[model samples]
Structures are given as structure tokens and as C-alpha cells.
Target: MNLKETQKKFHKTLSEIYPKSEIDTFFYWIVEDVLQLKRIDVSLNPDFEINEKDLKTIKSQMNRLQQNEPIQYILGHTEFYGMHFQVNPNVLIPRPETEDLVNWIVSDLKHQPKKHLLDIGTGSGRIAIALKKELPKCEISAFDISETALQMASENAKQNEVKINFVQQDILKLDSLPEDVDIMVSNPPYVRVLEKEQMCDNVLKFEPHQALFVKNNDALVFYRKIIELAITSSKCKTVYFEINQYLKEDLKKLIQPYDINKIEFRKDFRGNERMLKLLID
Candidate 1:
């Protein structure tokens, strides 16, 4: 079938579940990824025929999309901070705000001396890998409790041509990390049980919830533990986190006992204060 005709069917199959804008995006992304057909090319040549195998692949992808699977997971990879990462159900797909958190650190450290950076609960190793790629001189290592996530991250590091040391350890049970890193970065599980209703099925049903939520009554569990590690380890000079949007003031107060007014928060593109940069005094 030709590209334009198939795209019409694609929109029809998915419009009931997703908006037309999203379906159009899916059509363009799959075409680019699979057929190497740029959007402009598709627009200029509406009758561009997709080969048989490609048509079959698109059908399969359409089915998955209809099932509410994320397009990134369906493609088995995603772009973050201009780098491509391998993603799966085992790891949460990296989000744009997390990219902002990464850029915040990279921009701050780009002109400075190389620092050792540790990423806690580094599912898919998005933060650590992006930092390493941007700041090549900096040493990067990441930790995750799930062996599956660590494996996926390791593959992404290899694919990105950046070497990152990935370790398996639960943040809640850490006595200390492998070595003293100068920077700690995390986008840990801060979602409360109550927030699930606010999330989409692609997230609640497909993404790894172990990396998304804490107990409803204890949404700050990972933050508290990591901050304690920062104090006790006395190694991390600064820590960056992509936090739950609703918990900004609570996070500020939670870290205040350690060092009052040492924390600064960054807003994402949407103006929610979703990124926190905590400095140890």
C-alpha cells in the first residue's frame, strides 16, 4: 500500500484512542524510521508505495499503538538529549523534563574540571549516559536495583559509544556507593499511589511502576535515602533530581534539615518546578 493511504487507515484505527495530531506524528515517525521517507518527501509524494515487508511492519506497529503501548517501546528505542536509547517495558521511557535535568547539569559542568557523577536508580541509564556523552571527561556510573534495567542501560551506553559503569543496588539499602563521586543525579520514584489516576495507560500499564511510584504515604522515600547518602558519604557536592511536579515545596522542606536554603529548583518547559539541584554545605 502507498504511504498516504496507509496513513489514512492508521488514523482511522487510532483516532478513537488518540488524537489526530498524535496519529499524524506516529505516521511520520514510523515512516522516517522504517522507510527513510522524510515528512516533506511524504507530503510532496502522496502515492509513495511502501514495500510489502514495510507494510506488514506498519500493521504490527498500528496494532501495538491501538493497544496503548508507547511508540518508543514499540520501536525499541528513543531519543533523549539528542542521543538514541534502547528502551523496553523493563525500563521507564525517558521523558523530556528529565532531558532538561540532564542539560542543567551538563551546562553547569561543561567548562569545569571533570567530576565523577553517580546516577541513582538509573533506569535505562538516561541521565548518566547523556551526561557522559555531553561531558566526555567526566566519569559516569549508575546504579539500579533491577538487573533488567541495568542490562538495558548498559546496552544503551554501548550503543551511544559512552562508557558508564553500571551497578546493581537498591537505593533504599545503600551503605555507600562503589566510590566517591562528586555529583549525584537521580530521577527516582516520586509518584504517589494517588497520582496513578492522573497518568495515562501507556505509563501505568506499560512503564515499569517500580521506577515510578513510592508508597502513597511516603512519596519522598528515595529522596530522603539519597540525601542521607549524600550527607553520610560526604562525596557528592551536588545532586540533581527530576521530581514529582506536585511535591516541590515538600522536597524543599525535606532537604532543609540537612542544609537550610542550599537547594534550588528548576522548572521544566511547562513551568512546573520539576527539577531540583541540591548542594551540600
Candidate 2:
């Protein structure tokens, strides 16, 4: 079918599952992914025909989308910090809010002399890869509990042509590191398991649960563990986390006794307190 016809059909299919705005975005992304053509190209070349094989593949992808599978996973890649990274069920798909966390950390690092940076739970290696790309002189280490995730992160580092020490280590059991880090960052499992009832099927069903949810009784378990590690094991001057919006005040209170230089809570595009940057004293 022609470009316009294909888009119309795709929009209709997606709108059945998601809002019109999201459906439009999915339509544009699917077209771009399959045709290697931008929206303007589709407009200027309305008669562009997709081959039968490509149409079938696109339709299959749409079916997955309808089932609430993230488009990044469906496409097998996602753009983060202006670079493409491979994503799959083995790793949690990167989010725009996490991009904000990365930007905040990178902005702070720009003024400081280069030093070691560590990313805990480096799923898909998005944050570490982006930091390594932007701050080429800085030493970087990334750790993940999942063997699958670390392998994907290693591949991502190779793909980005950036050298990062990818370690398969659980933060809960980490010992002393090889060197003192200047900064540490993590977007750990802040979503409590009890919160699953409120989460969308796109997340709860398709994303890796171990990377997303913590035990209900201890919503801040990962936070507590990582912060303790940062204070004891890491030589970093600063630490950061992508936080759950509901636990902003609680998190600040939890870490106050540790003598953190500044515990700043920043809002995301949605105006929710979604990131916390803690400067370690």
C-alpha cells in the first residue's frame, strides 16, 4: 500500500489500543523504522509503496504494540541521548525521564576534572554509554546483577565504540571497588511490587520485573543498598538516582543522616519529582 494508506491503517490499529497522540507517534516511528523515511519524506512521497514482506513485518510489529509491548523492543533498538542502542526483553527499555537524569549528571560533570564514574544497574548500558560518549576522558564502570543485561551492555559499549568496564556484580553484595569514583549513578528498581496493580501492562508484562520492581514492604530497598554502597565502597563525590515520584520526601529523609552535601529533587517533563541528585560529602 502507499505511504498515506499505510499510515492511516496503522494509526487506526494503534488508536484502538492507545490515545490518538501516542498512536500518531507509533505510526510515525513504525514508518521510520521500516521505510528509513521521515514524516516529511512520507508526505512528499505519498505514493511510496511498501513491499509485501515489509508490510507483513510491520503488521507483526503492530500486533505486538497492540499487546502493549514497547516499540523500542519491537524495533530492537531505541534512540537515547541522540544515539541508538539495542534493547530487548533482557533489558528494561530506557525512558525520557532517565535521559533527564543522565543530562543532570553530565551537566554537573562538565565543570569538574575528569574522574571515575560508576553506573549501578546499567540496563541496556544507556546511561554509561551516553556518559562515555559525552565525557570521553572520564573513566567509567558499569555493573548489573543480570548476566543477560551485562552482556547486552557490553555489546552496546562495543557498538558505541566507547570503552566501559562492564561488571556482573550485584549491588547488594558489592565489596570494595578498584578505584575511587568521582560520581555514581543508578536508576534502580524503585517501583514496589504492590504498585503493579497501578502500572500499565506495557511495563508489568513486557519489561523485566527484576529490573523494575522492589519488594512491597521495602519500596526503597535498592535505594538504601546503593546509597550505603556509595557511602562506603565508592569514592565518588556525588551520587544520583532516578526516583519514584511518590517517595521524594521519604528518600530525602532516609539519606539525610549520611551527610549528603545536597539532596536535590528535580521534576521531569511531567512535572513530577522523578530524579534525585545527592552530592556526597
What are the lDDT scores of the predictions, listed in order? 0.89, 0.86
Superposed on all Cα atoms, the candidates' RMSDs to the truth, in angstroms, are 1.4, 1.8
- Candidate 2 achieves a global lDDT of 0.86
In candidate 2, residue 232 scores what lDDT?
73
Query: How would you encode candidate 2's per-residue C-alpha lDDT over 120-177 as one tens digit per residue?
Result: 9999999999999988889999999999998899888999899999989888887655
lDDT of 1 at 226: 84
Candidate 1: give its CA RMSD in angstroms. Answer: 1.4
List candidate 1 segments past 4 Å from native: none
TM values, all candidates: 0.96, 0.93
